[model samples]
Target: MDFARPLPEYLIKRYQGWRATTYSENKGWYRRLADEGQRPRAMVISCCDSRVHVTAIFGADSGEFFIHRNVANLVPPYEPDGDHHGTSAAVEYAVCSLKVSHVIVLGHSGCGGVQGCYDMCEGKAPELEEKTSFVGRWMDILRPGYEALDTGDDSVRVAELEKRAVLVSLENLWTFPFVREAVEGGTLSLHGLWTHIGEGGLEAFDPASKRFMPV
Candidate 1:
């Protein structure tokens, strides 16, 4: 298998077939809606890994979810300063502009960025500098999680830390004024989800239960 060439062509053809079927089967509903514009009901913040696809996981078709993907599923505290605010900007658009009812922070198992953080915390990796790289900077957001882990086993600790990171991101969402306002006004809800890729199931963070349960 030549990894690059065939895969791109295969996906393009697959999507073309899907589009044709969608138009014909829906009786031109998609065509009409295309002109009317999109109004997605929910927004998902997820990892940019190819294995974890937001739309596929949620069973969403086109215009169903407003998505933002980064190295790890992270939402940093809002800062009005002139930093490159990609995640913040996405959250602002989803909450303020799109007026999405629900915002989900979707984390997953075996995340490379989370693993990198674990490596750094263990002194297996070097401290990140500003000139280091984009991935290093991104993984820094999960430092609090890494520091909070008390488990003895490295693998267990990393997994727990990743889950903790999701909770952290959920709390960080409140840093944005618009998100806070919407949630307080009962117009918006935030959720944290962890995908167990090995099991092919999702564990949703239940605030009432205060634990993750199968979804």
Candidate 2:
């Protein structure tokens, strides 16, 4: 748990060895990306979980995908409170500045933050108010999803809540003017993807089918 300690010597050396190989293998790409700047074809909004890596999951190298990671991959509706809108800023940059053709919201199974939201909705964590933490406020975004669930089985309710939250985020994405305009103009499309971390598989949301299907 000693975070202040430097990386292990063996790991450091291994990374150093890979650096040369990576540079050699991607020399042209690196040179072009650096000179021309990044023009990624897609932008991915995902959860800030160590296990959920956007680049690694999509097999992307530098300048491939613009990424924004936040807790539970939640996208709050546009607000102007002179606050630090990290995720909103990234979305604006991706849609307006980068002009990415597609914006994907990636949700994953076994998400702790999502579970916390579910717990809060069920009144299982009453002491959360004592902490006055930002997570509590952020998790409130899923309140509607939790309230909409009327199931008896706890597991089923949690699963439905998670899926509903993703759908809610998709709706929230349109709250941004840039995202809405691009989608209406056919320049940008929104996609929702659910990843099962244990099995390393993905389910893509199908608007036509009204469900998530294996990808």
Candidate 3:
């Protein structure tokens, strides 16, 4: 408990500014949301990358999206073995409890997690190959996708792998019984998206073409 400390000076100042401006302007809306509870229409599973702002990209207001962020935006296949499952729990709550209509897996370029995964797979990151490495274990979810990748340049391969991570997550979502039921019952839909961090470009995965099309 002693490890916790007060906010940094800069963060404190930023928070105060937000409270004075944004909070003041949206006071009524904030109060309404607290009273009514969140009824988000979509659930976004995105990377832990600081640059991937799901709400900002969609111009969404508070409570408009149920978002879960994790390394490489991964979703492990359904494995109910009584172990702790953060992503699975989030998906269950979003699809079954909140009844969100859409679940979107959002991947982004220049993702450190994806880079780590690629390096680990290529045997260039021994630190991540240790049995005790949490990142390596979590990234094991992307192994199949990496193995299926077409031969190409390093840059192209990494870019394609980033989008492939989104597809992997989407596929895992289907493994969740609740998600599958919801989708098949016409109550929910799944989508995959990838973004270029530097270019501010986005692409949507087109199932028909099995490709990411510019958005």
Candidate 4:
């Protein structure tokens, strides 16, 4: 059953280059982080899209953020039925253990996962409807957001759905008692953000305006 292989040559070469330059130049910083362990100020739940570089967008360095990436960057409502909950576990650790001051949900434009969800919900993607499709099940988390979207052109609907993904996550995040308590106690805050991948533009959700304004 051995299917694993050595690192790809390109990846290895890149690692060697980074180690020779970045790591070498910041050896002390790396060493301190290794010994002191991570104490990030925020937890960022973001999409698995390679283009959405959270660190690069914020110009953050190592140990600055506790990032968790998943399909569409969705967060499920608190369901402690005892099954595997990767996102929930990360949230618990960040809010309870690490005691991060902020929890940020970041969505982006042209998200493949959101696009799939849009198609699945609109009955445009039959493959995603099968009972065995994990993606279909996962994307179910966004159904509420989909249903709430205003009827509009495909492009606008999809783009709005992307922002709704961030909103959905923020809403579900509060369903966790720990997160709610932390927020109520003024120890932690929740934020929603959306980025235009191509434009390199950012927007923040203002609960007051109930809109995403440019950042």
Candidate 5:
């Protein structure tokens, strides 16, 4: 319990600068959010990758989006086993409590999690195949996606699997009764997004088209 450590000097300086400038400039707005509590209309489920900045990418304000990050941006099927389920818990809170109108699953290129799934599926990473590996078990949610992909062309397969990550999460989100009820009642909507990292390009998945289009 005594393993806490100070943040790096650079990050500390960055936080101080934000507090001095950005936070100072938006003090009223910040205080208002604190007073009223957050009622974000949108919930974004994204990867835990450091490169994927949900707020900065969407230019969202402090209380605009309720975001959850996990390896590969996956949403597993609803299982009421009274066990720990972080992503499901977040989704339940967002949909039931927050009443978020929209849920977005965001994926990105060159995702290490997706790549790790690929390696594990292809028998390249033996450690990930072990049952005790947390990441491997978590990444297993995307194993169906890995199997559905055409692995003949290894170069393009990773990118394809990344898109599937978004798709899979969207599909799994519907399995929740609350989500299904909201969607059927026209109260909630699901969106999928895949970003072309380093290229400044974004693609939105069209369910009807079953393809991603530039946004």
Candidate 6:
């Protein structure tokens, strides 16, 4: 536990800088949030990549979003076997407790997790096939997405797989009975988003057209 002792020197300096500037500039907002607690309207499920900043993408203020991040922003099929399910737990709290109106699955290009799933499905990653591997087991949730993708060149396949990750997560979100009930009752909505990092372009999935159109 000693290894987990203190903040790094650089991070400590950064914290001081924030307390002096950013936090100071928003001192009233920060105080109000601390007193009122968070009441985010949306829950954004995104990849764990440092580049996928949910707040920055929306220009969101503090406490505007309840965000959850995983390997590929994946949500596994609903299971209530009294097991550990991090994403599902977040979804449940967001829906049943916080009553977030929208749940967005934010996928992105060049997702390392999606690439790993593609590689695993393509038989290029034998080590990932083992059940003991945490990442392997987690990436397995996207196997169905990969299977449902049409075969093509590596680049095309991976890109499609990235989109599929969003689609599959959206589908899985519905498997949570609470989420489905809320959606059916018109109290909640589901959204899929994909970002092209280098191009700085965004695409939104239209369920009706079954296409990802530029946003």
Best by lDDT: 4
Ranking 1 against 4 by lDDT, winner: 4
Q: What does candidate 1's lDDT look like per residue over 1-215, in tens digits?
A: 55655557889998889878875698566786679887889999998878997887878887889999987799988889997899999999999988999999999999888888788767787754344667777777888888878969988998887798798899889888999999999999999999987788899998997888899
**TM-scores, in order shown?**
0.88, 0.90, 0.98, 0.99, 0.97, 0.98
* lDDT tens digits, residue span 1-215, model 3: 99999889999999999999999999999999999999999999999989999998989999999999999999999999999999999999999899999999999999888888889999999999999999999999998888989998988898888989999999999999999999999999999999888898889999999999999
TM-score of 1: 0.88
Best by TM-score: 4
- In the order shown, what is each candidate's alpha-carbon RMSD? 3.7, 2.6, 0.8, 0.7, 1.0, 0.8
Worst 10 residues of 3 by lDDT: 110-119
Clashing pairs in 3: none
- After superposition, the stretches of candidate 2 with alpha carbons farther than 4 Å from their true spots are 1-11
- Model 2 has an lDDT value of 0.86
Q: What's model 3's overall lDDT?
A: 0.93
- The digit string of per-residue lDDT tens for model 6 on 8-70 reads 899999999999999999999999999999999999999999888789889999899999999
Q: Model 1 clash pairs?
A: none
Cα-based lDDT at residue 181, candidate 3 = 92
TM-score comparison, 2 vs 5, better candidate: 5
Position 16, candidate 2: lDDT: 84
lDDT of 5 by residue, 37-67 (tens): 9999899999999999999998999999999
lDDT of 4 by residue, 1-215 (tens): 48988889999999999999999999999999999999999999999999999999999999999999999999999999989999999999999999999999999999999999999999999999998999998999999999999998998999999999999999999899999999999999999999999999999999899999999
- Ranked candidates (lDDT, high to low): 4, 5, 6, 3, 2, 1
lDDT of 2 by residue, 7-123 (tens): 899999998887789878888978998899989999998899899978888888889899899889988888878999888889889998899999999999888888888887778
